[model samples]
Target: MMLAELVTTADRVGATSSRLDKTDALAELLARADPSELPALMGLLLASPRQGRLGVGWRGLTALDITHADDPLLSVGDVDAVLDVLAATSGSGSAAARTGILVDLAARATASEWDFLVRAMLGELRTGALSGVLLDAIARASDRPAAVVRRAAMLSGDLGETARIALTGTAEDLESVGLQVGRPVLPMLAATAATTTAALEITGEASVEYKLDGARIQVHRQGDDVGVYTRSLADITHRVPELVEVVRALPVNDVILDGETLSLDEDGGPRPFQETMSRFGAEVSRDLVLRPWFFDVLHVDGRDLLDEPLSVRLAELERVAGDWRMPGLVTADPEAAERLSRDALAAGHEGVVVKAIDAPYAAGRRGKSWVKVKPVLTFDLVVLGAEWGSGRRRGWLSNLHLGARDPEGEFGDPGGFVMVGKTFKGLTDELLKWQTEHFPEHESHRTASTVFLRPEIVVEIAIDGVQRSPRYPGGLALRFARVKGYRDDKSPGEADTIQALRALLRG
Candidate 1:
């Protein structure tokens, strides 16, 4: 297929508010796609290339000066071949090599094709064709059940491959996709509540566990081998050998554990989140040993527990993890849940996650079965721009202009970010220096005072709440907003929505 066809469909997907219309357009496109090209096709539509990060950034793309072709001549395969070269390019002269390749590719593509290619390379396509919608389209085009396709995608943790299988393979092949002991599946997610009591209202009788401010880790163990993956499914096993040894020591020969890992101080209290995160680097620090605390067990003793209730899974988790199990109690009492919440906070943890005792683990889905509670409101927001600092913080990009995801474009552009407010609080000297040095790489444009970004960075912000305001297009502004930290594990697409911020107005 021509690259122009995909770009036109993307434009059509972005121009409408109806999800049905979007799905129909994508389904039609999928129907015409070649089976061998499904992976690359899905990757382009999702703005996540099959080759992963191509080392391409906004600055690199903006540096090229080339006039695009008036007529579309590039095929999808032609663009994919170029991306392969760009992904493989590295070392001393990689920048020049990439620039030359991009120049040639740009000259061959039409103006619209070049625009789409840039957005795809940067993972910033603002079309409403998200993975869920695309999965629906695949199911529609393949004449398969959406649930089957979704389950296959979730279990395999590869949307592109799942698309190919669902489109070309039989129903039994899709259904056969199951929890493999060694392959990491997507982690289950949670909703949020103001308090443990409120969370219990949503979850009923719940296992209220301590919600640690640590990195999410999914450990898959088979015999003596263990692999640790992040929330985004990036394999970091080599970076965390200590964690691997810990999982290897588990009594069960084969198991899949879902939990969080963090470094603790001498007193056994959790350390700062940033300090814990640093353990994820390539260099293993013997001084900072990370400890694992298992919350849910997905598989044990060659049995898949994903379909089991939380009550069953927690029992299995206790038998396998023992002391390493996350601390919590099963209760329906609001006062008891509140007590656990206080204990978690006093222990320097985030708060509590109240989980329904009877709900099965719904991987990749954030349902009401599990709800997180925190005394103070914190949200994941996108950094839209950063102002040049003043006074003691001069030469640093300090004040962050934050944005919320506008998936439906009620406030502005569809599938774009809506500016909510700005803040300069909670930044340490290390963060200030880091921002000053790295912010230019993502620069979209800049004035004398501020440098606007491409909404690629996700930062966790603590806000007292949100107040109704006309100063921003979202009609709401963050109250006493302060940075908690950068959530490197999350994507801009996972940032909290403007409607979610607006709901704070009602509270």
Candidate 2:
């Protein structure tokens, strides 16, 4: 098994959008991969190593050195030389090293090498493949059931665990089988419906609470010790010591709670989502104006509430959280819930999440048990730039540069706006066409098809909230902001004022 073969399969997978072709190509590649390299291969296939969230990376040269450095069997200079070759060939260290290492090992290498290397390195080998697909492939290759292989891969966080499980029938042979303190488990998610008609059918009631625009967090506490994790399962305990302290102060001992961590203003209202995100660091002061609002409990005193109905869990949650819980909690009442939802929106919060009282907790599942609704506020904003879209949106404007009014002359010249982040949603065919025509007029720079536009056109945008941002020159960013329409009626001066933004921030 050589790396060249893996690269070839990856090239085929990347070029075609057909799932069947991709799977077949992947199967062929997996067949040729050495048993030891299967984990890395699986990671490459799933775009896991490229995700960067899991701490596994493929930044060409730096990644190549780090990967080889972990191998006790390989020499330092050997890894460095491989990285050097990779840098020369691809200019991206790890991708080049990956190709160089494979080509150097195999005497017969050809034009296919370039194709394979490019696809694998770019991490664009999408073939309509799911994690389940790769699991089955590994099972078939190693002579194991897909379930056994899936569990091994998940428990060990490595595909080699699948091969090991297949070769050795014992489950104990798998590494990191038990739940570890720092390890991340996929957090449970809820399915949502858009309209009240759908909500009534799903829960038989319109019962809902306002859904604040904040980060979802899971807190695990054991007596005095506590840990907090994001929805992505990243351990952010060190970044949020205030949350740890708060969880530790809970009345009950040994508990697992699910909640949202938000930044609040001095008046105790929820701050912008961006502000909460900016506070995620070790150096963030303890006095930082942020708070954690616990919503549900999954485990308490070593007891798992996963099998219990929502009603039962809510009782436990209320008992444990008490005053620390989120503001609104309703039972089977629909009308009252709707009022609360409206009040949340009027107060400048996002929409609400409605959960069924009797629904059991389903971990890592998005079913019709829970729903989220947010009030959309639309304002005319200027476009600053566009990033090239990928996959289905490839070649079109993926994200747009958004800006708000600056009457105070604080951001730029009087009446001038600043660059916020970009968004891909809420664009109509007409708007896209208009942008394509007018964007070039304001083009300050161009990289490929992506053009940086001058802030001129006033495009209407609907947003969830406004939050403080370090990236934007205006010192603010929009939450879940998307295009609504082009505000042909209003000029740039008629756009929402900075005072309104400040009031929303206060709210």
Residues 1-507 of candidate 1 have per-residue lDDT tens digits of 888899999999988877789999999998898887788988999899988889887877867889989999998888899999999999999989989999999999988899899998889888888888898998999999999999999998888788888888889988999999878888899988888888988999999999999999999998998999999888889888889988888888999999999999989899988887777765554578888999999998879999999999999999999999999999999999999999999999999999999999999988999999988899999999999999999989999999999877787666689999999999999999998998888888999999999889999999999898899888889999999999877998889899878876784
Candidate 1, superposed: residue stretches over 4 Å from native? 67-70, 283-286
Each model's backbone clash number: 0, 10
Q: How close is every model to the real structure, measured as TM-score?
A: 0.94, 0.60
Tens-place lDDT per residue, model 2, 1-507, is 454455556556546555455556666666665555555556555544422322112232122321221212322223234434443444346444554564452223334443333333443333434455566666665555656566555533445446545544454454324333334444555544444444646775433656776778888888788888876556778888888888888888888888888887877778766567666654656565568888778778867676688778888988999877876765556666667777887776777778777777665555678866555655567776887667766656657877776644466444456666578787766656667766665566888858886554667677777798788786667888887656433345445555455545643
On the 0 to 100 scale, the lDDT of residue 268 in model 2 is 70
Query: lDDT (0-100) at residue 92 of candidate 1?
Result: 100
The whole-model lDDT of each prediction reads 0.90, 0.61
Best candidate (score: lDDT): 1
| lDDT for predicted candidate 2 compared with the true structure | 0.61
For model 1, name the residue pairs that clash.
none
